[model samples]
Structure formats: structure tokens, C-alpha cells
Target chain A: MRGFGVFTTIALLIAGCGGGGGHGDPNPVQPTSTPAPAVTATPIPTVNLVLQLSSSVGVAAASFSVGYEAGRGSFSGSGAQAQCQLGSSDTLAVNDDDAGTLKVAILPADPTRAQNLALPTTLTCSFDETGGTVTTAGLRIGDKKIGVIDGNGVVVAGDSSRLDVR
Target chain B: MLLVVAAVGHCARGAYAAGAPSCADPNGDGVDVIDAANVLRAAVGLPSTCASAPAACDLDGAGGIDREDALDVLRRAVGLAPTRDCLPHLQLTEVVHDLDLPLFVGAAPGDDTRLYVVEQTGHIRLVKDGTLAPTPFLDLSRTISSGGERGLLGLAFHPQYVATGRFFVNYTDTAGNTVIAEYRRAADPDVAEPTAARVFFTVTQPFANHNGGMLAFGPDGLLYIGLGDGGSGGDPMNNGQRLDTKLGKILRIDVDAYPTPPSGNVGGGDPDVWDFGLRNPFRFSFDRGTGDLYIADVGQDRFEEIDFEPRATGKRNYGWRITEGTHCFDPPSGCNLTGITLPVAEYGHDAGCAVIGGYVYRGARIPGFVGRYLYADFCSNRIWSFVRDGARLTSQVELTDDLDPTHALGGITSFGEDAAGELYVVDGPTGLVFRIDPE
Candidate 1:
């Protein structure tokens, strides 16, 4: 009876420490009658990105990643909101609807700048959804955190804080 | 950043916070929250400020502050933008006066070194050897009306001006009609025989306004004359569409041969008609390198248009009395869907009222915009450029404020080129001449 009492106290202490109800014991003694059917779920793909400055004037480089859901499908190209001078160049990329990636480089006119610095501190990559508008994710300069930007490349609310690179 | 936020927040609180479904600030004093927010964002270096709130910083009251506003402040602060685009840069250097009263401006073939200007009262002036000859080269003001759209409207030296020393002028007669006349340098080489006036072609003007009054020699050596639509508003006469009328059309003539010479006229020829359907073609020029022709036509009410005629095409009809500038007139008659030429560049009356044609910069000084065509406005005082790639024309920039705005060239009567291919502007109202140079 002494031994049984000691065993009972030990069991109680273990259960309490584990914080698990009787159904979820770390070392369950239950042996399933039949193996649970193989659980199969679609895995979300991860995006990789990098920012490179062609003309160096100490401008910060920014990067970002986007996530796709089951119904969201895939993304196409990406864009950056930049203060570019006349004849400054910027590069962008994104995942396409078919899971492929699209990339583009844009050089806009900026005749006013003496140094011709093109600072695209924020970037947004988006993908088209099946029934809804395009889903977008953004990245501030030198950070991997994704946010939201409008169609015109403006940072929306809740995403404004993430765009501060300076 | 704090200022921007405060301003935006204050605006949002004053306007949108009121909770009016359709808010109306009667005095238009309510600040736009979105705009304020954008200003803050831009000032803070957070993404783009203008991309979202374009109207918040509309400092010029033009409804939105896009690149123009940004550029405006930057230009005012920094003097001028770079002259890489079509807009002229601020004159960091000195503003020199090569010649005043540079009436008519013309350049010699293949050379920009020599500049020729016509004195409005008659007589051609030359800027050669870095000095303006004190005497008149040719005197025809006595024969010219010297009135509206009259006097010496155009001057064109033959491509072989070095050999022939021959040139032509487009002026209005005492009858206020369009005349293409020819003249030659006198034996003294410095003076012109006033009696040496030779009538090339005379087209009677129906009214005072749309005489078209620009004469240019194409690379093909065909003399092209621009005649305006018989004047009066809305093209009441519809002379532009009529093939029989020389008014409102470009007349291409072969002036090398004489059909029936005027009794005292030294040079006479049947001036064959070129492309038609022009309304007050104030100025026109041939691209020195490609021979492409550019014509600037003044609009009646709504728009000012620039027409491009490639050297290869003949008898092109620019839409006049029909579609003014990519838009149909109020009544919309005679603006046919077929067989009408369109302008390469156009602007609204609000931006500029009249079009002043200028030369394509073939000069070496402006390397970035060498192939681009430069033109100006009479009222808005704006100078603009159009870059042609093959047949496509892209607008480059507006350069009004970049120029000396203190001297608002009320009427941009003509553009002149020096012996070195540099260009000059003649303001009719001020009788002042400005030369375009590199900073």
C-alpha cells in the first residue's frame, strides 16, 4: 500500500508538471487500433529576394518576401517606390500566376538631380487572386518584413511603419 | 515628418472627422487628410508621398501635385533642372545679346555658324564674324504691310546659300494677301537692292488672321508655304477642306524653274502647291539632319498643335476646321474619319494659346537633346520639345520658367539660328532677341 501510494503521487506530479489532460500524455500507453490515414496538405512556397544597387551613392538596399494561400494561387512581377532622378534605373521581380517569376528593370527620367541618385527604398511584390483583386506584399529597405502597398505603389495603413528605412 | 503628420492629422480632423456623408467645405479651406498623410510620408522618407495623395501638395492650385509641382519647387529652389531633357536649363552663364530686333531667323545649309534675322520694317540682318552687320541686307518693309500676321513672316536661304546667296520671304501685301517673294544680295554683298523684290507666288487672303505665313525649303528643294484657313471663327468658310483654296493648306512649289516671270522679277517660277489643311501655320522648319519637317499651327479656341511631316511623304493634310487637336470641334462637322493628318504634339489653351515653331537642335552644345525638336508658345511663354523616333513623337519637357521669365516674350514671332547652328528667340513685343546656349 505504501509503494502504491508513492507510485500514485509520482504519477500525479508528472501529469501536473506536463500540464496535459489524460488524453494528451507525452508517453501515451494507448496503441491505436489502426494507423491514422496519412495526413496530406499543400505546402506553402517561400520567396527569396535580394536588392542590388547599380550606381553606388550609399543608397540603402531593401528586400521582401510574399506568401501564397490555397486559393490565392501565385504572383507576377514586383515594383518599388523610389525617388529616382532623370535617367535612373531600378529593378523589380515577382512570382507569376503560373508559379513562375517575372522581373523587370525600369529607368525613368530625373533630370533635376545633380548626382542622379535613385533611391527605391520600398518594394512591393504582388500576385493575382482567382476572384479578388491582386494580393500584394511589401518590403522596406534592408528588411525582409512584408507589408501592403496600394496599386499606385503607396504604402497603405498598418504598412506605413514598415516603410521607414531612413 | 512631424510637421507633415500634424498637418495631415489636422486636415483629417477638420474635414473627414466631421462624419458628413458627403462633406462640403464651402470655402475649399478644408485640408485633405489623404494629401496631408502623403506629404508626411514623403517628408518622412517612407515609400512615396505623391503616389497616394497627389492632390495634397497642389501648390500651384492645379488640382494635383505630381512631378510638375515637385519639379516646380525644386526648380525654384535650385535655379533650373538639368538641360538633359527638352526643358532648357537655367542660364548659369551670362545672357548675351547678339542682336536686338532679330526679326526673321534662318540658318544656312549644314552649318549653324551663321544666323540671319529679318528686320520687321524690312531688311535682313546678318550675324557673321561674331558681329552684326550695321547695314540692312534687304529692304522690303516698304512693300510689306507690317500688320498682323504680315511684315516679313518667314525667311529661307537656299541650301546653297554659300553659292547662290539667294533667299525667300513670306509676307502680306498691302492687300493683306500671302506672298512668297525672292531676293538676292546686291553687288556690294552687304546691301540688298530694294527694287530687287521678285514675286514668287501671291495667294489672296480672305481675312486678316489665318494667312499661315511660313515658308520653308524642304531637303527636296521644294519651297513649302503655309497658308491659314480663310479667317473668322470656327472656320466659317470651311476653306481648309476645300482643295481649290490655297488658304489653310501647305503649298509645295518648284521655285527652280520659271513659268511666267513677273516683269521686274529676276527669279520667277510656278510655285507648285505642297501639303494643305493648315490653320495659321506660324512657323515651320526642316530637320537639318533628317530633313523631317515640323509645323506649329495656332489654334482658334481650344488647342495648339505641332504637325510633323516626314521628308518622304508628300501632300499630307493636317486636320484643320475639323479636329483641332485629337478632339472634335463643338459642332463636329467636316472633321472626317479618313484622310486627315494629326498633330504630333498638342496642348490645351490653358497651358498655351499660340504655337511658335522652332528648329530641331542639331547643335553639338546640347548633346542629350540633339535630335529633339524645340518649339515655344506665344502667350504662356512655355517652351517645349518633341522627340521623334522613326515616326513616333514623344513630348520631352516644358521650359517656360527656365527661360528669363522677367521678359515674358509676349509674342514669339520667330526662332533664329546662328552660323554655328545655335538658336535664338525673337520676342515681337519686346523686340528682344535671346540666344539659346548651354549652361
Candidate 2:
């Protein structure tokens, strides 16, 4: 029992480590202020995908998928869109971790007017084992390529850069 | 090593179990948009405490939680079961925008770098390398009357544009005549010399509005033209059924094959007319896969129709003044429906005002959506598609529902497709271009 408790404590500490040394806000509305876990002199196995879109038309929903080469570890995280999906802003729901598919939508959003830039969302997938190649595909902007952002602050439309898993 | 695998197995199992659908009750408010919004917030790195039932947010019950789960939950909350095959969840991504009244958009035969857009004010704008080129391909504003339903209306590139560099445009000239003219690309390959235009044919218009101005190169490499029944309501000139007028006709000419000046082609499409008796065929398209032709003919008072014909369907008379949408028009009762080609599908004003013809979903991206004919209504802003089950093209389904509740596809003027067979749509009111992408 003591050993189990110690391991649980270690796991919580890792979860509390918000990429950087700081803590995550957990406010549910404000943008999460941390980048994905950064690799130090000793590389850590984790990657984050920050997808941002600005459309002349409003964004009601969006979905995407990510894949990694073998040994890249499994990924999992849905930050805000899940809250938007379930009609609550205060709830934390990590969703869309199956087969790498993620989905989100703003219900009752504008049906006529052109929307300005929408706040970006992130898919933080944690890979336990790392070292190889990481690619992102299946961004669901109605099957069209829209703008996207990487954790390093690079934003592009349709085209994306692959991450080295080392 | 066994312990390590066992520990990872326990973690994966716990993650999946924790993400079960019942965990979505963060605030105990039941699964709702607030919860869905909370999921979105979480996915985008926002802080949310689905502390109550976090797994509820994991609608898919996958080991991890993300927006796809949120989407499934949102859909269930909204009572929508997505039928992936029946509907084309097409999303339009804007390709280009901001120009004067873009009437139609056409892509050249072989060039994938540029999209040729015809503006109603007599200019052909080029969208090259993802941005609008500063120079106009050809500006006939000085020669065209830029008013209601006139100006440079339609554009069609030569089948071998790489070799010929020649293309045809249909427009109403300053003298109020429908002009079929050909222009060649300049030596620069990016810009075309407007002065090098050769007039192919011209028909004087008695009235304006019904001037059907759409040009396309048939699969057989011949140029096809769409014309309206000579304007003033009810086919006033009785031109639709009259075998002598170019008005109310879908003309076909061997302009590229002839490679010469006009011989004043007229009646019975002698030198160039392929078919006649149409009322304002606002738009038309040829199936890139089957070479079948479709014409969206604007109705007189009641219905908007889509007429279809096989590639070799020569000498067709789509009864316009005589019949509208398979119904009697001129005589109203005794009008003969025989011999004249009929519309494959049609809708009344209760549905929309004008029809914008569209392309077949032959693009390689969406396999399930293949073979479906996509089209739209200008007034309703609704998009629809259907596949032919047999000889009859049934199974009509609405594809633009999601768009309707979130955006206005303002006045769909025309549809275009790229060299890759990807589809595009144009709305006159927004003066924008959108590509149809599968969901």
C-alpha cells in the first residue's frame, strides 16, 4: 500500500507539471498558458498540437487526427472543445483519444455573419515512449485544410511540419 | 519487464474506463453544450473541471479524451446521428475573394497554378499561387455594357490550353449583342493579350435579362454556348420554339477546331448551334467522369430546372416557352412534351429562386460521395446532391445543412473544379470563392 501511494504521488506530480515549471490554470475558459512539455538535456517523450483557425465563415465544428511512428508512445488530450461540446465551460473533459480522432463544435454559433478569428484549441498527446517521427493528419475543417499552429508558435494553412520524436 | 507492461496496461485500462461516457457531468448539468464547450476549452488548453463526470466528455470511450468525444456527445445531446454516407458533409474553404461581382469561375485545362474567374464588370481575374494576380487576364469593360445580367459572363479554357493558349468567353457587348470571342494567352503565360481576341459569333439581343451566358468546352473538344429565350417575359418574341433565332438556344461551335473567324453562324445552329429552345440557361456543366451535360435553366414563373443530356445528345430542344419543368407553359395544357428534352430534376419557387448547376463528385478525396450530382439554389442558399440509382437520378439529399445554420452561401453564382477534380463554389453576393471539401 505504501509503494502504491508513493507511485500515485509521483504520477500527480507529473500531471501537475504544466509543460513548463509553472502550474496549469484549470479555469476552463482562459487559454491554457503552457506549451507542451519541453525536452531538456535529457529528452522527455511528449508532443503537443496547437490548432488555430481564422475563417471568413464561422466555425461551428472541427476535428483532427495524429499519428506517430512506432515507439513514439500513445497520445491523449482534449482541452476545451470537449467543454464546448458538452455545453459547459467549467468542466474538464479529455475526449477524442480513439484512433487519434478529435472533434469539437460551437453549437448555435453564427449561422449568417462572417466570424472573426476563433480562439485556437490544443490536442496535447502524451507519448510514454519517444524517438522517431510524428505526423499530423485528418484535420477536420470539413475535409478542407485550414490554418494550424504548432507548439513552437508556427502557424500555417493546410501544410504542417513533422516533429522529430527524439 | 512484466511489471512494466502490466503497469502500462493498467494505465491504459484506467484511462479508457475513466473516459467512459458517463463522466461528462462536470457540473452535474447533464451532457449539454456547456459540457461540450467545456470539452472544447479543454482541447484548446483551456482549464475546465469536468471533476464530476470527466469521462462523459470522453463520448467515444477511447483511452484518451478529445473533441471527437465532445462531438459525439454534442451530437447525441442535439439528437443527430450522423449518416456518413447519405449526406456530403462538405465544408467550403475560401480559395479567393474580393473582386467586382464575380459571375463565374473556371479553371484552365492543364494549368493547376491558376484559377480563371470572370467578373461581371468585364475582367478576368487570375488566382495564381494562392493569391489574386494584380493584372487582369482580359478586360472587355470598354467593349461591354456592365449592367444587369450583361458584361463578361462565362469563360471556358481550351482542352489543350498548354498548347493552344486560346480560350473563349461569352459576354454582352456594348451594342447589346451576345458575343462569343476567343482570346490567347500572352507570351508571358501569366497574362493574356486582350487585343488578340477574335470574334467568333454575335447575336443581337432584343432584350437583356434572359441572355444565357455560359460557355464550356464539350468533352468532344467543341465549344458549347447557353442562350436565353429573347428576354421580355413569356418568351414575348416567341423565340424559344422558333427555329430561326439564336436566342433560346444552347449553341455548339467548333471554334477551336475551326481556328478561324466567324462565318456569322445562326439558325438551326448551322455553323455552330448544337441545340435550341432554352430559357435563360444561367449555368451548365459537363461531368468530368461521364461527359454528360447538365444545364440549370432559370424558370419563367414557377420552377427552376436542371436539364441533362448524354454527350452525343445532338439537336435537343429543351422546351422552355412551351414547357417549364416537365409542365405545360405556353399553351398551359395542350403543350406537347414529346421530342423536346426534359429536365432530369427540378424544384419550384417554394424551394428557391434561381438554380446554380454543379459538378459530379468525381474527386478522389471522398469516395462515398462519388457519383453524386451536387447543385444549389441561389435564393435558398441550400445545396443538394443525388446519385442515379438506375436510369432515374433519385435519392436527392441535402448536403449544406450544416452550412445553412452557421453561414450564408450568398447567391451561389456558379461552381468550378480544379485539375485535381476537387470542386469549387462561387456566390455572387459575397464575391468569394470556396472549395468543396469532404467532411
Candidate 3:
């Protein structure tokens, strides 16, 4: 049990390290403590968001929706999908409603590969902030909709880090 | 290891001593889902409490403790009797072969020597005494549409077939509409009169796929038919939840009275609709022993489900567009589950794509096999069975490895039960009819 706690702490630390540049509010608090570092400087052209998925007994499939500030930012680039660091054969689909919700679903093609995945996998995506100077943008994961299935076809409890866009 | 051998013998008995702390329930806390999980953990070499006594974990007596052992314990955990001894040493014997795309198999009442196989191209072939009949019993290829989830899909003989010489068929017409028709046997017992095809009402299909064409006579003597949710994908028509349409429902009617629906059907729907909210109930069956109904609804993307309805219950709303296999589907999250009947058992696409519902084994030939409901998949060709203990589904064991060791049974499309309650599987691609037999 203690070893599992250490593994969880390490995963959280890795997620915390990614917050160095974008500096998202890890907690669900108001964006008051830290002012936008890039608001005064040259307006940040693009902001990268990192999503971390943590499961104890590996992951076979993960599906969740991300709701972001639509007025301040819009998903950019050719493929507008989160480039997930999953198995090469995994099926990944990302759909943007253009409003605020972005539905992301990942299903491993080879189930055994998912069973052998290392814990705490990461996915990264970028969006272009156009309107006014963008500060720490509002990001929320849909509740009661997220599902992370494990190797045994059982839906296991999983955790994902909060997203903050600069 | 005399003690180990004795333990193996004790565990392989195939009967669960009620409330006795056996290998499955090592700590005697009354086996539940946790014990089932622990056995699975041990099978994968993970840290598990059952790992301490691995000998006892060998539930099937297959020389070593593996996933099958864990599955057996899971059966016990879910209030089902042990089927450890019946798991292995089963084989599929090819009874008939070399035919066009066969979709279903059946036998008339009191007719044990002959089997009737339905081909998708609108012909009912006869196999008698292990010999294929040169002439089809009934042929309607010129009149019906065939191919890709259409055609003559279902056949069911009346409960009093011997006395009435009557049988019904479900097929898609040339205009792509579902047609339920009744036919009678000719002077010869083996041949059916093609001119006797009496057409019932026609159901206009919206799309090509998801044509749920399965016909069966319930124990109550009512003819039941399965229809898909108007084809396409994800039930876009929302026909599953709609009462105005009979697209995603199990329709019941009395053939003797033409279109008169029997009493005790769910109120306030299409008079023919007995139950609704099914995506594509490709296949369903009634247990000869318990008279319960089992419907295997193929899932849209992720899950395939097995729905159960008791003999006495009617008017069940199996959640379809609202949910798929016990999870929110339409709204995608937090959908209302009120007044909905969920599946008794479900598996994801990792196991199979489409579920082919099979019958409850009540045949006398296979010992310790009765009361278990068997099912298969079209894409995976994997055969699995589970015992339903009251409302819970227990003892889900995959019989693919033992039943089809050489993979001779290819792409199972449907299962057939003879008059004597013996089961046969229909291989659509290979046109092989395999009878499940004990080795």
C-alpha cells in the first residue's frame, strides 16, 4: 500500500512539473493568486495543455470530456486532437463541439498492450488564444461521465490532473 | 504430494458444497465479488490473498491455476453452482457441411432425426440422418431480398407442429421490408409447400443493417419476433424507445388468430410490441427448463449485452439509446435509468463484436451442463456460457477453446435446439452445422 502511495505521488509530481510553464491552478480555485505572466509581455500565441491519466492496474480505455473557455481560446492546428502517448495501435478520437466541450476517447487496439502500459500516461494538445489577453483559462472535466477501463474489462477508479491554459 | 492430489480431486468434483469454505472461499467470508477479483489477481501473478494456496485455485483441474479458475470462482461468487468439470473436454462435431450462407437451424416438434437449416438466400435445406437433402424444403430466392443482414433470417416451428403441420419464417422482401409468413408441410414430411407462403403484415425497414430477424414460439404459444432499431448506427432513429414504431421491439402475435395479439402484453404501445428499447436484438431464446427469455443485443461501439426476462414478467424496457450495456449512451453521461431493465451480463469489444444468443443447456447428454445459457460472437467466434442464479448472471465460462479447438466452426451466426433439446451452432461463412457434444 505504501509503494502504491509513492507511485501516486510520483505521478502527481510529474503532472506538477508540467505546470512550470503553463502554471495551471492544480486546485479548483479561482484564477486570483497568480497573475497571467504573459499578459504584460508579448501576447502568448499558443498555449499547450498536458493531460495526465493515472490508474493503478494499467488502462485499457479512457473516455472523458474537457470543457474549456470557448470565448478566450479555440483548438488550433490541422488535427486538433490530443497527441496521446499511448500504444501505436490504440484508436484515439477527439471531437470539439466548438463551444467549450471537447470529447476525447481512447481504445487500445491490442488489449494486451494496454494491459502492459506503464502507469500515469500523458497526452498533450495545443490551442490558439485569440481574443483578449488570455490568462489562466477555465478548464473543467465533465463529472459522472469519465470512465477508465482496466485490463480485466473492469472500470477502475482513475485520476486526471486539472488543466490550466496561460 | 498425496495431499495435493487429494485436493485436486476434491476441487474437481464440479459441485459446490453450500456454505462450505472451499478453495474459492479460502477465508470463508462467503465468496463475493472481492473473492472473484482476488482469484483474478492471482491468475495474473499479481499480489492476491488466493496466491498463498495456488493448488486450491485450480478450479477446473486443468493442471494449473489460470483465468478459467478465476472465472469458475466468479461463478460461485455470483450464486451459481460450479461447472468446473464441464468446462473442458467438450468438442464440436460437424453434422452437416458445404451449403450456402446458412443463418439458422431448427427441428420440428417430435422430429429428432432431421434438422432444418435456413440459408440467407431464401431456402430451407434439410439434413436427415447425417445426410444433406438434394432438394431444399422450401425455396423463395426470387421473391425475397438477400445479403448483408437481410434475407430469410429466421424459422420457427409451431409448438404443435406435428399436429398442425405449420411453421413460420421471417424474411426481408425484395423492397427491403421485413415479412413474416407462415407455411405448411407438403404431402412428404421432408418438403414444404412453397405456394403455401401466406404473408402476414410487412414492416418497412429504414436502413439495410441491424435487421433483427429472429422468430420463436414462446412457451405461452405466442409467436415472438425480434426487430432492430431501424438499422443505421447508434439507433439514430430513436426507434428503441418509441412506442409508435415496432422497429426495436419483440413483437408477439397469435398465428392461429392472424394478427390478434395475446393478452398480457405491455399496455399502450403498438399492439404487437411486447417489449421495446433494443438496439439490435439479433438473437434471443427461451430456456426449455425455466422458460425464461434471453436476448443478446449487439452494442454500437464498446459493449455487447445479454438481457434476461423471467417467464412471468412482461413489458420490460431494455435501455438502448438511453444506455448501452448498463452505461449511459444517448446523453453520454448521467442518463436516467428509471423504469429500465439492464442486461444481466455484458462484455466489451475486447471479447467480441456481435453477440449471438444461445439456448439454456437442458440436454441430457452433457452432464453438469444443464441450466447454463450459451452464447457466441460473429466476429470473434468465441462461445461463452453463464448460469443465471435468480437475477444475477454467474459462471461465465468461455468454451471457445475446448469446443472449437481446430477453429472448424467459423463465424457462428446462430444456435439451434432440436426437439430433444440438443444444441447446434450455425457457421455462416463455412456453412457448417456443428452439434455441441461431449468428448
Candidate 4:
């Protein structure tokens, strides 16, 4: 009986193992028909811009120009920049080269007092493409920058720059 | 003194002798008896330089002691305008009193009247005859919070305080709520104790900053309380324009009668909301003589405004969210300038930072400034005065240099007055008080 039982158990175990292998063995390995493509990074574009001021008072006229790619693209434009003369008539202009060079000039209507006026020494510019909101800070004419202003022509900020005179 | 007078009289009558310098001609111009008597009085006090016979009697400096000197003496005696040299030099007296926890002050109707000062942490002090009473007139500091800008921001004695002995106080509680409590002094006019305390109205403040704690009874006898627009910057919640919320507005309520019975029942549902659209009306006062109301509304930035409300008008809107001092401040619709009541006077941040409302000087002492309304700034220590004629408000003038410039105490938080119509200013930072008088 023992010999018959051992032979039957070994046969059942072999059948179970064969059934498990049969259920798990299908589609063990597969190959891809096509390969994925690699991605390439893009570079950002840069531009050199210049801003110029005309008359120093009463909605003073101003002009701006952009030079990009070593003079490959040169654009000259005119628009109003809310720049006013500090206590008198002063004007300012800027020239920028796509080669990373910026040149700024302050013209004083009253040249005799130009030395006394401190022209702004720094300028910060920022813009938003979606909102079209461009803001500039630290803009100086001679050694001074316009401090405060209202919707009216009244300048609440201090004006020590001789370049503010239009 | 009597013997000298008698000798002078004898000389004037020529009784002593004929050559007695003709008795110095008491009436040098030879006027009548009354004129001669006046001239004699004037010449009697002449010094030795002027006492050279007839020239001595020329007290008028008009060449003689004649009718002119007599008239001059008479004018001087009757309190009429005297000549420049004869005018008496005026002197001023300063009286400083030490007060314990002087919280708020109010004045009633008469001369030689008393001033009521409220001490934070509770207790009402009475300054009568320029002396503070030893005991407190009333005490309620036990229930007061005494926190930021809280604790007895305002006190108003009913116009008929003499008869009614009733007064009101606006204070903040432990929970940071503004309460306008009414109390009646005991039968004894001097003591504030033995009084009945009653809570007339209570307002729950969302935040502490803009509580608008000033309470004043307007000319109409209605209590007007100034509440700040719930205190965060920029009016983030839009509390000023919304009428349903009482947060940024000056509220008027009739405290004479309870809307409901003595029980906890409420009736008529707040018929007291008088005017709205205010940021934080720090201090507001009505002209004691005229009923016009002047409000000092503290602004957010760039501007401090003084709003004027004529007594005749009732419902006037002072634009808050939509406008600040006649200018568009917020975005979208900056300011609706059409129907809003504009401020009579406004100063930029350069001149003054915050506006402190003051009383209109109706006192008799300064007759020239009788109808003018006086106000000051907390930051710049500038004193300003405005005159309103009919519906027009004149430009304000700086009344600086009249009071002690050092008395501003960093910032002026409140202005008070005594019974005689004298004005006082309270400095918030230094906790000092100054009385404004004629220079």
C-alpha cells in the first residue's frame, strides 16, 4: 500500500507543476516594432535696446531702437515714455548693442546747472509678454531718479537731476 | 496816602498860598468840575520830570493836563482802549496737575464748570475747581479690556448733563468688542459712584486694528459711533461699500429709548444706523454753537482726510472703497465721485500722516477764532483750522506755533475740552495731555 501511495503522490505533484508552468509560460517575452525619438533643447533669443528722450516737459517726446544679432536686425521706433525733467528741462538717451554694450547720455536744457544735478546711475527694465506690462526701476538721469508721480503732471518724487529739464 | 491827597487838593484849591505854583493848575485847560476832578486824578501820579509846575500836570503828553488828559483818564478808568504806553502788560499763568490714569475727558455747558476724565482700567475722575476729587466718580475698569486702542476711547455727557447727570462711555471688552454703556451718576453731583450701569449697545469687532471706538452724541441727541473698516490693509474684504455690514462706517443710534422693553427682547431691529462709508473715524466732534459735524477719517496711505457733515443733512455717504479723499484709490472703478461726500480738507503723507479731529473753538476767550474748527495730525504734529460757511468749506490754515510743539507726544490720539470751552489734546504715545489756550 505504501509503495502504491508513494507512486500516486509523485504522479500528482508532477501533474500540478506541469499545469502551473502551462498557465504562466505564455507571452514571456515581446519585442518593440518601432523606437522613440530623442528631444533637442532650444536656445532663447536676446535683443539689445535703446531708449531716448526729447523735450524734458509736457509729455516729452521719446524714441526707442532695438539692435539684435550683431546688427543683423535693426529696428528704430518712437513712443512716449513718462519721463519728466527734474525741476527743469533735462533729457536722456540710451544706445544698446547686441554685443552686450550699453551707452547712456543725459542732456540738460540748462547746461550751466548740469553739474549740480545728479543723473540716475542705474537702470532696471522688465517686461511681461502675456500682459504687456513693462516696468523700469533705478532709472537715473544725471545722478538722481524721479521719486514719485501721480496721474496728474505733479511730481511727488524728488528731482535732483539736471537731465530732467526738457 | 490820605495826607498827600489832602495836601494836593489844598494846592489845587489855592488854599495854601497864591504863589504855590498856582496849585499846579489841576485843570490846566480850565475845564468844568467833573473834568477838573479827572485831570487832578491823572496829574497826581506824574513823576518829578513832569511835575515842573504847569508842565507837571500834563499827564496826557498832549502839552497840558487839560480836557484831553481828563478824557484819557476817564477812558482808562472806564476800561476803554487806552493810549499805547498806558496799556497794562498782560501776563499768563500755567497750571499743571498730576492725574492718575487719565483716560478720557468731557465738558458740560457753563463757565467755572467741571471736566470728567475717564481712567483706563476703570474709574471716572472729576476735575472741579481745577482739583481732582480724591475718589473716583465711577469705576468699570474691571470689565474693560484695556488692549490696543481699546479702554474708554470716548465719553459723552448728554448736552443736559447738569440736569440729567447721565453720560455714556464707549469701551472695548475682553472679547475685543466695542460697547456703548450708559450710566447715571448718584444723586450727589460730585461722586460718579452709586450709579446704575447699563449696556445700551455692543458691537462685535472681527479684528482689533480698526475698532472705530469713538462715541459722541450729535446735536440731534443721537449717539454717533465711528467704527473702522474691519482692520486689514487695502480693505481686502470690501467692507466699506457694503451697507449691510456696519464695519467701516459712522453709526447713529437713538439711545434715549430702548427699542425693546427692559427684558432681553430686541425690537425695531437697529433703526439707529445713521450714516455709513467710513474707514476709521478716529475722532469726530460737533460745533457746540453750530450743529455741523467734523470727522477725522484715518486713511490707508498717501492721504488723511477731514470730512464735514452739515447738521441739516442726514444720510450722506463718504466713499471708502470706491474713493479716498476725493481721489480714485482702488482698481476696477477707482472712485465714484458723483454722490459721495467729499472731504473738506486733505493732506498728503509728506505734511501729515494721520488726522486727529478737534473741537470747534466756540469759547469766548478767542473771539477771532470762534467759528473755526481745529484739527491736528498724529504724525507731523501740524495743527489745522477750517471754517465752513453755508455749504462751502474754506481751505484749511496751519494753526501751528500757537501751542507747545513739544506737546504732540509723538502722535495726537484725542482732543478734549473743559466746561469753559477750553480745548485739550491727548498724546497717544507719551500719554501726555495739553490744554490749548491763546498765545
The best candidate in terms of TM-score: 3
Candidate 3, residue A87: how far the Cα is off, in Å: 52
Each model's number of backbone clashes?
A: 32, 62, 1, 26
Candidate 4 structure quality by residue, lDDT tens digits, B1-439: 0001011111122211122221223323321222223243334442211122332234322223444553443333222343412211111123224554454567765535577766655667777776777777776677677855667677887777788777888777777788888888677888764444778777787777777767787777777778788787767777776666667777776666764222221123334445566788878888878888888888888777888887746566787867776667776354557778878777776767777888887776665566777777878776666567666654244444335333334566667877767677765555456676554
Sort all candidates by lDDT, best to worst. Answer: 3, 2, 1, 4
Off by over 4 Å in 1: A1-166, B1-103, B110-113, B260-271, B405-407
Considering summed lDDT, which 10 consecutive residues are worst modelled in model 4 chain B?
Answer: B1-10
Q: Which stretches of candidate 2 lie over 4 Å from their true place?
A: A1-166, B1-86, B257-269
Better of 1 and 3 by lDDT: 3
Q: Give the CAPRI class of candidate 3.
A: incorrect
Give the Å error, residue B361, model 3. 0.5
lDDT of 1 by residue, B1-439 (tens): 0001012211111122223111111112332222223333344344443432222233422222344443333222222232112222333122224444445676667554455677666557765544567766776767878665566677887778767767788877777877888877667656656664578667887778777767777777767777888787777887776677677777776667744221221122222436665778878888878988888888888888888878757566677777786567734664464787788777777766888889898777766557767787788666665567774554344444345435446667777665556677887666556677665
| Worst 10 contiguous positions by lDDT, candidate 2 chain B | B1-10
* Cα DockQ of the candidate 2 complex: 0.02
lDDT tens per residue, model 1, A26-141: 66433224578998975444333333333223222222233335354444332222221122343222222243322222212232221122554333343444433333233223
For residues B1-439, could you state the per-residue lDDT of candidate 2 as single tens digits?
0001011111111111223223343334344444454454444444443322333343332323565655555554333452112233357888888978887887887677888888999999999977998888888889788788888888988999889898888889898788888899999988888773688778899987888889988787778889888698989887877777778887777775554313434443344556767888878888888888888898887888888887666678889889987789988999888888788888777777888888887888777567777788888776766555446665454455433435577788888887767788888888898888765
Q: What lDDT does the true structure give each of the candidates?
A: 0.54, 0.63, 0.72, 0.54
Q: What is the TM-score of chain B alone in each candidate?
A: 0.75, 0.78, 0.83, 0.72
